[model samples]
Target: MTQNLYIPASTGGTLMSNMPLITSIEELTAEVITDLLQAAGSLTESQHVTAVEPVSFGDQSGLLSYLYRVGLTYSDGAQGPATVVVKLPTDDPNQRGISDALGFYNRECTYYNVVAPTAPFKTATIFGQAQATDSTDFIIVMEDLGHMERIDQVIGATLPEIETVLKALAKLHAVYWGHQDLENLSSTFLPMDNPIYHAALPGIFGAGWASLKVNAPDLLDPEIIEFGDNYSTHLPQMLAALNTPTTLLHGDYRADNLLLDEEGNLAVIDFQITSMGNCAFDIAYFLSSSVTSETRAAHADQLLHLYHDTLTAEGVNYSFEDLEAGFRVALAFCLIYGVASFAGWDSFGERQQELMRSMASRTIYSILETNALDSLNAN
Candidate 1:
């Protein structure tokens, strides 16, 4: 956990008014990696460590710890690159945060194959132990696609490119269709499964909202706060309605986690929250999160038609009208989550916190104040 007892916003001074400690972003700490490999039973004294660091990606990835890939030379000179991205849980008590985050790493390695050449998604491999004795437990060693950029950056992705990504989701969901009996079956990706919806509600509903209504009244209204409270109350029923014939959901199925190969093929990554839920969950995820709100709002119906068209092309026999109905039902769920994303991640600051608290208010308000639920009710 950040040692700092963070105020809702910066108090205009050092994060810690008194206490101070050092933080590093150098190559993987040899000691940390050594402890990791030792715990995994893969460490030999012969293996030498090179580097470790918390890296920054794009403009939005501010809080991530990206241990940059390295060269691993075995005793006999057999060598490979260390490409594991270990996302550890912070003891941060906000929500059962890192607790839920661990699921993503588990799903990625235990369920989703990182190296399988079967799909067009940016695949990643899992390592032995998720983390050391610390709260951080999920670790991933992946086939580094560092050479490629995310599809979002590669504008004008040909029909083939988009087709590849959408088809990959189809192929995955098809394989895992209705897999509830298995011991390691996937769980619902986001929705109320998120820590905020689960554990952070007290904080959000209590201090967070109370603070907002008093200090930042312009950011939210009474109805918004009510929506947040009601959403939590409605979570179980909402999730029950969402768990139709399940498909593998790439929890965060946005371009951010997708790496586009040299040939512009899509490879999905960041499966920490992979779950079994409505196939519409994945569709809602892709369209709602991947496309900008403006573009998606303008093209919502068009895109809904396209998803059914894409699914049909892949040999799945579902009618557009019906599928769109399912998707629309899921849209209220998506819109709630989507609006909340305005709080965004990638950095730790007052602005981010305010954005999150405000957006949560907006999410609450919008869900309650308008006829937004009409989409879910239309059919």
Candidate 2:
């Protein structure tokens, strides 16, 4: 069962204010672990953590956050997992600013606190959570799901894996298709039509293109570069077209964020960009970013239909034609991600650079193959 004890520094008053905004692994001491667990009702007065060993995900972690595998020893041999995953804000000021501006930290914390328990798909269990008053800083002590097999995005995913993930994604869309919870938390899970996106994405995209010109010039040819230059001008229409048929979106649904087991169970993580949008956008983002061009060319039609079939089987009214059309527009917009990859060029190493290259190449290929921008104009 997932714990519901979320004490934000803004609202938890005296007690939570006392809970340190842990910005580093060194601050995640044995005493701090006891407080977090106790606050979440996972520990008692007599039961406390006596020692902690934290191993950081120095390079494998996301740009917006730092991750650690914290091994724990409890007093009197009280029961608990040998280790748990601790997520904290990134030390990079620029990255932290980006996270705050985009509301990434607050969104993920809120997703676990409010939405995860009833969510249809699998995700890490939140043992404890604390957000700063400004929502810029937060800590998530969650289940250590590192044992699950993670797919490599640079190598890309197989047809079977994509099929399984899409089917599960369809179910997630079906369950939250027009749920009131979406409306109740509209501010936290911004609808695609939100003006804030219009305000922020253009500048970020422009910066990304500039960064790429300097760092990864070979990645973008003139034609693709021309399309990127005109992306912001077309943003409003694309976003307007994507706003309908709203459902819960796992905004960054890709290979790296997924964990699969032998039984074929799929667990999704990284809800930083979680929002409300057309379900097809999630499908587009997943396929364009995670699968190779060959896989998409051979199986795109079948895989898309599989998602449509799965969604309709759950009684959704979306048409296959509409899904196809929305997919094209979504694919065009996925360039934002590929382009954004360059914005953090200094932060990424050779492996991450390879992954970004794969993503950018596949995204550009799919866009041209489908004439995604023309589809967007038609929309």
Best-matching candidate per lDDT: 2
Against the correct fold, how does model 1 do in TM-score?
Answer: 0.63
Q: For each candidate in the order shown, give its overall lDDT on alpha carbons.
A: 0.47, 0.83
lDDT per residue as tens, model 1, 46-135: 664455444434233222233335444333542334544444333334323434544443344444432233333446543332332232
Over 52-139, each residue of candidate 2 has an lDDT whose tens digit, in order, gives 9999875852277888999999988577678889998887665676788889888898888677776777899877777777457788
Find the 10 residues in a row with the least total lDDT in model 1: 1-10
Q: Model 2, which residues run further than 4 Å from truth? A: 1-20, 38-45, 60-62
